[model samples]
Target: MELVPFKDTGKAPAQNFTGDVYVTSIKTPTEPSRLTAALVRFTPGARTNWHSHALGQTLHVTEGVGYVGTRDGKVIRMRAGDTVWTPPGEEHWHGGTATTFMCHIAMLEASAEGDPTTWLEPVTDETYQSAGN
Candidate 1:
């Protein structure tokens, strides 16, 4: 048993997100592991750019309402305690609702080798609005 050091809550880079967002590292496997966890917070109307992990990702909502959208224009509305999963290489984005702040614990599987996360273009406003907020 050990206590890992806490990381600073810094703004999420625009390179991977749209609008203002922040993330704090909760756990990062040092060796013989490929799992990572983060506590991500999104401001109202903020969200991630379309992206996917090589192995997949899971999100567990902890507060407020969250929006999850897929490449096919399907948006899932999630509330506190809700859990969502994105299969390997599936394009999607997740974030806060238009009028609420949102936070979730993101679990990502690190690629073994040669495979990496594929990031796609940003989600357009037209598609965002279609999610019905």
Candidate 2:
């Protein structure tokens, strides 16, 4: 195995997130593989739009408080050591709390057709308001 160089991809665009968000690539599909991973950092109140991974996705929280929610309105409160797994094609969104910056290691595998994630509409204010810190 070789060391994969880390790349700072910079802040996620507002179109894909509600507030300031950043990502650092830890690993990418090297070839003949679909595995990819990144360290994602979210500013307070920042969050991803509704999305899902093709194979599944694993999130390991690295710092501060974060929130992950599903369509059915089940919001999971996560801390620095928390780990969460979202099954394949299960639409969801995650982000930092209103008052805290958060960071997590996001790991997922792309499908054979080179599809890794499917992005849906942004989480509405009505939906996000229902979440708990």
Candidate 3:
């Protein structure tokens, strides 16, 4: 096994995220590997847009508090050591709560065709505010 070098953290794109968020690459698919992972951090009130994965996704909370939500209005409060999984093709969003900064390790596998995620519209302020309700 080879050790991977650390990479710099970067801000999450405004096009796909609301408020302040950062991401640092952990691993990316290479050759026979189809897995991808990253360390994602979010400031209070920051969140991802509605999105789905071709092969599903998993997130493990590492610090602070956050919420994971779905189109069906299901919201899960996640704290450090908590993990959540979203099945393939299910639209969802995740991020920090209004009063807490959050950090999680995001993991997923690319589809056979190499596609992993499809991002959709941003989660509305009303929707974000209603998380966990």
RMSD of each: 1.4, 1.3, 0.8
Provide TM-scores for the models.
0.94, 0.94, 0.97
Candidate 1 structure lDDT: 0.87
Native-vs-model 2 lDDT? 0.90
Answer with 2 or 3, whichever has the higher lDDT.
3
Residue 89 C-alpha lDDT in model 3: 97
TM-score of 2: 0.94
lDDT by residue (20-99, candidate 1, tens digit) is: 99999997766687788999999998999898888889999999998999988888999999999999888999999888
Model 1 reaches what TM-score against the true structure? 0.94
Leading candidate by TM-score? 3
Put the candidates in TM-score order, highest first: 3, 1, 2
Whose lDDT is greatest here? 3
lDDT of 3 at 48: 99
**What is the per-residue lDDT of model 3 for residues 1-133, given as tens digits with 9 covering 90 to 100?**
8889999999999999999999999999997989999999999999999999999999999999999999999999999999999999999999999999999999999898767999999999999999956
How many residue pairs clash (N, CA or C atoms closer than 3 angstroms) in each of the candidate models, in the order given? 0, 0, 0
CA deviation > 4 Å runs, candidate 1: 114-116
**Whole-model lDDT per candidate:** 0.87, 0.90, 0.96
